[model samples]
Target: MTELQRKLYRQAFALALITIFYNIAEGMISTYMGFQDETIALFGFGIDSVIETISGIGVAHMILRIQQNPNTPRDAFEIKALKITGFSFYILTAGLVVTSVYNLYSGQKPETTFWGLVIASISIFTMWALIWAKMRVGRALDSKPIIADAGCTRVCLYMSVILLISSLTYEITGLPYIDAVGALALAWFALKEGRECFEKAKSISVCGCSDGCH
Candidate 1:
């Protein structure tokens, strides 16, 4: 690796650490508020944040490994980690779908979603910045795992938007189903991300490359 690439790897590692910490805090707050308000969407979003933190830790470990031994080939451990992350996403998708359907069927309504709105709004900006940094570093280093991690962050951004819109719409109209709809949207987004992560993992296992790499 060149000096610049080394620098980028260091930056990516730092960013991964930041992602871990941020997601921990976000997940705790969101989950707490979710339970307090009985909001399925917010609760699911918090779980997703926790899962993303796992991915961030994996990415950080991979970056450190690569930095320590630049010539090391992608190994089974890394592939397994990616697969686990991908599988977790699929599980999240299924859970969200089931929960949303139940919420819709039961006509459940949140008691209050003020904190959901606040958290989602803050998440949007934070995730955007993280996505930008991760993409920049991933592209610079041509690291599939880092890029895939960034893609995960992008999904989080979409979830934040969904949460924000659903919370706001519910606050304004007092519609209960809209919150369920947002959870469905989150499920759809997570399904897409899960597929992408699995595909990337397959590609790396077979050819040691991500989709965009030649």
Candidate 2:
């Protein structure tokens, strides 16, 4: 391997680690704050972060495998991880849907969505930086896997935006249903991600998180 390729691989691996650790921390903090504040949207978002951590592990393994041999196929561990991630996403979707419905039926409102706003703003900035860096490294190595990882990060970026908008909207208008609405939106994304994970496990060319690399 050339020195440039080695350096690019190191960069890619580092990005994967960053993504994993960041999601862990984000999940912990968001879940804590969400529960404390009784915000359905924030809670669902946090849960999603934790599930993303699982997928991130599989991606990291994928990076290592492809680094060793670009032509190597997906291994058992990666497939298992993908299946686990898929089930987790589906479970989360069902959970969020039920919780959101209960909240709406109960006419419940969050004490504060202040923390959601804060965490989501941070996530947006962080995801954007990761996307840019991953794209740069992926292109440097001419790696489709790395580039596809970047596309998945783009989906996370979209979720962060949704959280930000929902939180901000609720704060501005003091609406009770907005949090539930936001959670339902997240559920939709989770459903999509779940289906895609299984598709990724079965298909060689699928990107894993979102439908396609693009």
Candidate 3:
């Protein structure tokens, strides 16, 4: 790689590290606040963040691997990470589905969705920034794996929007089931993420593209 490309690779690797740390921090805060307010959406969102952290580690490692050799296949480390991320995502999906159903049937209501609103807003901004930066670096390097990682960030942006809307709706209408509905919405995304993880593992490319990670 040329010096400029190497620099871009460094940037890409840094972004992955940023994503991992941010997910960890977000997971802790959201889980705590979700428990305090009993907001299923926020609680589930927190769990998803934890899963993202695992995926981020794999992504980070992929960046390092490709930085050294762009044509490399998914290594054992990346495959292991993807498998863990996939299974965790499936478990979270199942748990969210069960919890959401029970909450709906029990007429459960959160004390407040205030924390959801806060976390979602912050996440919206953070995810957007990360997506933009990752995309820029990916395009600069002409790296498919990095671009696909950016796509994943876009998914997180979508989830944040869901959380924001659900939190605001519950706050505005005082609806008892809105939180559960939001959890269900999140569960759909969780299922998609889980499936993507497995698909990526099936592909040789780090991004799961059959042609190549580039």
Candidate 4:
């Protein structure tokens, strides 16, 4: 592999590992503190993080597959990974929409937590880094799966922004209901992105078509 390819793979691998750890931390926090807040937005955030972690795994798997077979046919494992990741995101988005609707109907209010805020802030920065790095690498290598993976991180970044806004709104208004609304909005965004990814994957016939290697 070229030096650029190796560098890109390493960066993606490292980001994937970081995403795994972040998912674990988020789940722990949700288990301990999520019940206190009725908002359900935090729960959605945690769920989304788990989805992102899985997507990261898909990306890592693709990179590893490529490494194992440097001369592997372009339409082999990489295309499979793209389809898998797209399907995974679609499911994740569906779940988020369901949870969001339920939260909105049930009038769930989320309590403001300092730790949650801190974690969200840290996640925002990490997501920005991941998205930027992935875009650079994906574009360089003409890798569709990697670019789709980067799209997942972009979704995460927007979700973080929604979470931040909702958290701040809760702190200011003490309405609590706004959190659920924020989550619904974020879920819509996820669904949109997820569908786009799915469409891209399904429409493409080959890994290195006009769009690029899958």
Best by TM-score: 3
In order, what is each prediction's RMSD in angstroms? 2.2, 3.1, 2.0, 3.4
Superposed model 3: Cα runs more than 4 Å off: 205-214
- Model 3 lDDT, residue 75, Cα: 82
lDDT (10s digit) by residue, model 1, range 140-208: 887776787788788789899999999999999999898889889888887887787788678777787
Poorest lDDT segment (10 consecutive residues) of candidate 4: 205-214
List lDDT for all candidates, in order: 0.84, 0.89, 0.91, 0.68
Residues 5-51, candidate 2: write the lDDT tens digits. 88889889999999999999999999999999999899999999999
Best by lDDT: 3
Q: Which digits, one per residue and each the tens of the lDDT, describe model 4 over residues 1-214? A: 7887788777767767777787767756753555565546676677666655555665666667666665554453445555665576677567667876776687655656454566678778988987888898778887776787787778788888887777777777877467767777767776776676566656655344533443
Among all windows of 10 consecutive residues in model 3, the one with the lowest summed lDDT is: 205-214
**lDDT per residue (tens digit) for residues 1-214 in model 3:** 8999999999999999999999999999999999999999999999999999999999998888887787667787887887899899999999999999999999999999998999999999999999999999989987888999999999999999999999999999999999999999999999999999888786654455322542
Candidate 4: residue pairs that collide: 38-108, 38-109, 39-109, 39-110, 207-213
lDDT of 3: 0.91
**Better candidate number, 1 or 4, judged by lDDT:** 1
Each candidate structure's TM-score, on Cα atoms with residue i matched to residue i, is 0.90, 0.94, 0.95, 0.77
